[model samples]
Target: MFLTGEMLIGQQSVTGSSAPISAINPATGERLEPVYLGGSEAEVERAATLAWQAFDAFRETTLSQRAEFLNAIAIEIEALGDVLVERIIAETGLPRARVEGERARTCMQLRLFAEVVSRGDWLDVRVEPALPDRQPLPRLDMRLRQIPLGPVAVFGASNFPLAFSVAGGDTASALASGCPVIVKAHSSHPGTSELVGRAVQKAAAQCSMPEGVFSVLFGSGREVGAKLVAHKFIKAVGFTGSFSGGTALMNIAQARKEPIPVYAEMSSSNPVFLLQGALSTRSAALAETFVTTLNNCAGQFCTSPGLLIAEKGALLSSFVESASAFMNESSTNTMLTPGIYEAYEKGLSLLNDNPNVRRLAQAKESDLPNQCRGSLFSVGAKDFIQDESLHEEVFGSAAIIVECDNFEEMVLVAESLEGQLTATIQADESDLGVAKHLMPTLERKAGRLLVNGWPPGLEVNHATVHGGPFPATSDSRTTSVGSAAITRFLRPVCYQSVPDMLLPDALQQSNPLMLKRLYNGDWEV
Candidate 1:
C-alpha cells in the first residue's frame, strides 16, 4: 500500500535509471514526495518481452475465467478505499467529490467490461457446414471467430487520472478482448499511477493470470513511449492526450517495420449550436446553463462546449449579455498541472490579442496558483469561417461564440468546423426544420450528436461513443469507451476444413460456449 517510485514489469518492482520525475500539487504549487525515475529502452524491452510471452495463454483463457479476472481487478481497486481517493486528490488537485466519483467510474468501467466478456458476444463467431453433395464444387466447412491482437501499449492522460489513467477504459477494453496491456503512466501523477498499478498487479497474481498480463512504466519524456510503440512485440496502441502527442505516437506506430493500429483520442472543441427558437423562449435560462457547462471542471473535459454558434438578433444579444454577467461572477478553479495552466493562459492571450476576435466577458482575477478563470469571446461568422486558427481548440475554460447574420450563415459556420467528439443542437419544436437541415453536416463532422442538451459529462454504458474523426482520434470506426471498445483489440480469423477435435470451443460443432452465432447464413440462437 506504500508508494515506492518503481516501474512494474511482470510482477517485479524495478527502479528506473533514467531522469527522475516528481509530481507537483497544482493547488498550492508544492511538489509531493517519492520522486519517480524514468524508464529507458531496456525497461521497455523487459515489459514487451513478458507481454509477448503472456499473449497466447492470456488470449486463450475461457470466457468465465477472463470475466472473473476483470471482476477481480474491480474488487482490488475498490479495496484501496480512501487511500486511493486521497492520493488522487493530492496528485491532480481535483476536488474530493470529483475524485470519488472518478474512482467509482473507474471501477464501473472494469465491471462493465467484465459483464461484456462473460456474455461471449464480442467474439462474433460464425460457422458454415460442409456441403458434401450440394451444388457446383461442394463447399468446405468454415468457422470464424475474433482473436486478440498481441500486446497493447496504452498512454495515460493528465485529466481524469482515475477514470482515464492506469486502469481506465482503454486498459479494461483491451484486457477484455484478451490482449495483454503495458501502460505508460502519465508523468503528472506517478504516485497515483503506482498505487493503482500495484492493485492491478495484485489482481493478476490472485487470479492466477499470466505474469505480464499488466504492467506500468514511468517516463519523463517521449523516449519510453516511442521505444515501446516501435518494439516488434507491441501489436496495437491506445492513447489519450493532445493532438501533437497523439500524432507523434501515430507517426511512430506507422513508421515501424510492421505498422500497428493506434487509437489516440487527441482534440475536440465539442461545438454547441443554439437555434433561434430555443434562444428566443429561454435566453436567460440557456445562458445560465451554458455558463455552468462552460466552466464545469474548469472546462478541461474533452466534451466541454468550447464553440457556440447562433444567428445575430435581439434574442442572441440578450443571451450574450446574460452569459457575460454570469461569467464575471464565475469562480476560478484549480487546474491539473502548472504546464496545463500556462498553456491555458497562452490560449486566452491569443484570443485577447486577435483583431478579428472580440472579448465579451472575463471572469474575476484570482491570486491562487494554477487556477482557471472563465472567459467568453465573440467573432463574426465570416471571420470564423476564414481563419483556421479560430477552429483550433484552446484546451481550457474559454469559449468563442460565432455571431451569424442569418440561418444560412449558421449552417456555414457548422460546415467550417473540423472533426469533433460531439456536436450539440439546442432547438425546440419550432426549430425542427433547421435542425433537420443541419443534421447531415453534423453527422459527418462529429461521432456523437445531441439535441436540446449540453455536452460536459459522458455516460459510461453499453451505447456510448467517446471517439470521433481525424484529430479527435486517429480512428473513427472505433470507440475508446463502452462495450464496443473491445472490438479495437480484436481481429477475425477463419478456419477452413479444420479437424473438429482441434477447433476452439466457441466454434465447435456442439456450440459449447452457447454463444449466439451465425450458422449457414442463419441465426443460431
Candidate 2:
C-alpha cells in the first residue's frame, strides 16, 4: 500500500485542512513527500466517542480472539515490506539496516504480546469459596479479576520511530489488554506513522474487531496530544520523550477533572562506573565499547551511557585517552531530525562554556549537514556534585568522565546522582569489594544494573525494566515495556455474592478461560 497523508480515525480517512505537518530529511535538509495535516478538536472528540462505544465489546473479547487480533496486526506490519522501511529511513535519516532491524523488532514484540494474551496471566484472577456455617453471619462468595481500562492515548517517540512509535510497546500492550488506542503521531515522522497506522486498521478489520479499536492522529503535541489527554474518555496515557514533555503531560493528566495515570519514560544518563580492577586490566577494550554504544543511532537511545565514574589514577587516564581517540576518529553520523541536531549543539555549548567542565576530545567537523561528530569531556567529582547542569542529558554522541579522589568520593558521587534507566559497573573478580559496596547505591539509582557490558541493548522480556524513578519515568510502579506493561491499562474488579451466570468468564465457577488464578490460599490447578 502507498503511504497516505490522511489520518486514521476509526474506519475513515481524515484529512485535516486546518493545520498541516510534514517530514524533513535531516541529512539533506529536504522536505519529503506527504504533507500531513492536523486533526481538529472535533476529530479528537469523534475518535474518543467511537472508542467509548467500542470499549464494552472490545474488553469482553475472549482471550483467543484478542490474541488472534494482535497476531493479525503483526502479520499486516510484516507485509508492508520495503515501503515501510524506506519511509522510516527517509524521515529519520538513520541507516537502512537499523530501520529494517527496528521494523522486525516492532513486529516481533507485537506477536510476543499475542502469545502473552493467549497465556492469560495478566488477568490476575482470584477466587474464594462461599461459606454458610461460619460464626453468626456467613461469609459471602467472592471473586476478583482484572479488566481493561478505557481508551489509552500514546505519544509516539521521535527516537525509535518504529519500536517506540505508532505500533510499538505501548500500543501493543494496550491493544493486547483489550483497550482501544489513539496515537498522537510524532511530527518528525508523519509518513511513517501513517503507514503503520493503516496496517493496524487493516488488521483490525481482517480480525472482525470493533471499528474504533485503533486510531492515529497527526499534529504537534500541543494541539493534538494535549487535547487527547484532557478528554474524559481517555483513562490512561503512555509517553516516551524529554523530561519537560513528559512532565507537562503528567501535569495535564493530574489536573484533569478525573485524574488518570501517565507512564512517561523521560531523561536518563545511564551512568557507568569503571572499577579499579577492570580499568587496570581492560581499559582499552572498555573505552572502545563505551564509544561504540555512545554513538549508536547518533546516541539517540534513552539507555545511552552518558556518564562515566572512575577514580583518579594513571589507569583511569589511560582509559580516557583511549576513549577520546576512539570517539574523535569515528565517522560522522546523521541525527534523527534538525531540531534534535540543533538542540545537541546547544547542549554541547552549555558544557563547553562551563568553567569547571574540561573538554577532552573533539571530533573533526564533518562536511555533511546535520552530521553529529562524537565528543568526550571530563570533570571532577566535586564540580559535578555542585553543578546541576552537569547532570542534564546531552542527548547525542557525547559523554563525561568524572574522576574522583577515591572509592568513598565515588560513592558520594553515586549517591548524589539522579534517577537513571540503567547503571553499569565494569569490574573484575578482584574488585568484588567495591562492586558490593556500590551495588546498593546503584540499585536505588537505576531501574536496571549491568556488569561489564554496555547499556544500549534492551531486551523485550518479562524481567526487563525499561523504566525508573522520577525523571526516568513518571510512574516507577509499572513499566512501559515487556509483558508487565499490560497492567498499565488494566484495573481490578471484585464480585461479591454474584451468581455464576452473572460473573464474567474469567471469574466464573467453571474456570472457562483456563487462566491461572489464586483460590483461597492455593494456585489454580
Question: TM-score per candidate, in order?
Answer: 0.99, 0.99
List per-candidate RMSD values in Å. 0.8, 1.0
lDDT of 2 by residue, 401-421 (tens): 999999999999999898889
lDDT of each: 0.93, 0.90
Off by over 4 Å in 2: none
Please count the clashing residue pairs in each candidate, in the order shown.
Answer: 0, 0
Query: Could you say which candidate leads in lDDT?
Result: 1
Off by over 4 Å in 1: none
Worst 10-residue lDDT window for candidate 1 reads: 452-461
lDDT, model 1, position 164 = 80
Specify the poorest-scoring 10-residue window by lDDT in model 2. Answer: 217-226
